[model samples]
Target: MKHIVPVKWLLARLYESDVVIVDCRFQLGKPESGREAYEESHIPGAVYLDLEKDLSAPVGEHGGRHPLPDAAELTVKLGKVGISNDTRVVAYDDQGGAMASRLWWLLKYLGHENVFVMDGGFTAWKNAGCPVSAEQKVLIPARFVATVQHNLLVEVDEVRESLGTGRYVLVDSREAPRYRGEAEPIDRVAGHIPGARNLFWAEGRQADGTWKSAEEQRERFADAGLSQDDEIVVYCGSGVTATPNVLALGEAGFTRVKLYAGSWSDWISWQDNPIAVGDEEARNDG
Candidate 1:
């Protein structure tokens, strides 16, 4: 049960006794908005995980906008929300797997193996004609153990070293415009990492806004010069959107992927850090 659960699977699991459904709907522009929508209406018995309050630490110049929360804090938060070792957790967000993938990554990082991302998120669920329940579900607290896997993440130095050696396939999950140094709406500088190939996470989504099948995802990875097994590192503006690619690659059967959690935004903000623009890219700094 390490893979993302399909819409049909989740619809049936809605009635499972120990299932934990978390609504992770969020907007990058207005962070508080996701919770409001959840409070208004959500999957019956679903609880909310706030991106800022529950999922991330406060933004700073050093850390990206939504830095990963402390493992201890997240364990407490998940427990307070009634998560436990045996819980079958299902998470979803509005942007297909955008925000939901974040929680998926977090849960995996914390060593929760059975967690699933609701394919297509809430929209897909509603489109499937599943019933929505607004009542907040009561929870009985249970112990959640978080054994953070340090290897799942990569720092900037690790990326820099992998560059000259060609030891890893660096990938930018941002759109081509942003990855091409053409249009950057959020961050200060508008370019991607040097030598990193483009694999926009949005491509992983279907026209209807749900993840494509695992076979389709595997093909996309192969098209990008990525095989089912490769030493690959993924990144987006920050660490958030990149998780979708992480999920996609994993779904595609690549188990060696790692995330540069402090991605472009974090890279550009540094004075002596490497910067690249246009089609030709790589490091200019020592």
Candidate 2:
């Protein structure tokens, strides 16, 4: 039920019954790299989940690049991966929990509270000299039901409304350059939403790629002007990377946090939506 699990704990329970380890390593540009890596070698008994194919639905014009997959369909997919209501799930990726947190958040949104993201991700496992295996695991399928939590997500309309009213603290979780519109390598527009403050998702990690402690995380959010009671909504280029910020917010004692699943990609999809460029002060008028 822990939000983050240490690599040592994961290794200790690597092959335990009712425990499922998911490998979520992925590259945004090369979608096949994650599966290829898993095929070569992964934690013993670990199953692979592709960020684009397994975790997200097909990309469309409006829902950003990595949209949430259908809940019923995702439930079936989880069942196929041997995840049930009672199974303890642990997900990890090479890039900290950037990709893995998506799976962690998805499971939590689906009402599976026993899921956790492996701290430091797969890199930590390798660094610690844990054993790896190339043999694929085919688990006995179990039934998984999606008990969706609608409150964890905010639609485009909600984001727009909140922006106008300042009712919610909107956070843009992309890098500073992307938020400042200095450079955008992805998405059509090279800017961010109006009135959004930049809180790069990478700030949640330590120099070694592990997450900071809850005390340190709280301090980080405080430095960013966030408080525990603020109605915070986080978004990024797409919905994927922002999950780590959501996890960080939760660890920092924030209760009213939600993910803007459609993010900036979906925002710019509409011709009417305004784009903000330059410094945060200038973007305030966007």
Q: Number of the top candidate by TM-score?
A: 2
Q: Write the per-residue lDDT of candidate 2 for residues 1-286, one digit (tens) a residue.
A: 2388898899889879999999999998998999999999999999999999999999887999988899999999999989999999999999769999999999989999898899998778988999999999877999988899999999998887676787988899999999988999998788889888899999999999999999899999999888777899999998999999999988877889999988998899888887887777554466
Q: Evaluate all candidate structures by whole-model CA lDDT and list the values in order.
A: 0.85, 0.90
Cα miss at 74, model 2 (Å)? 0.5
lDDT score for candidate 2 against the true structure? 0.90
Off by over 4 Å in 2: 281-286
TM-score of each: 0.94, 0.97
TM-score of 1: 0.94
User: Against the true structure, whose lDDT is highest?
Assistant: 2
All-Cα superposition RMSD per candidate: 2.8, 1.6
* Candidate 1 lDDT (Cα, 0 to 1): 0.85
User: Between which residue pairs do clashes occur in model 2?
Assistant: none
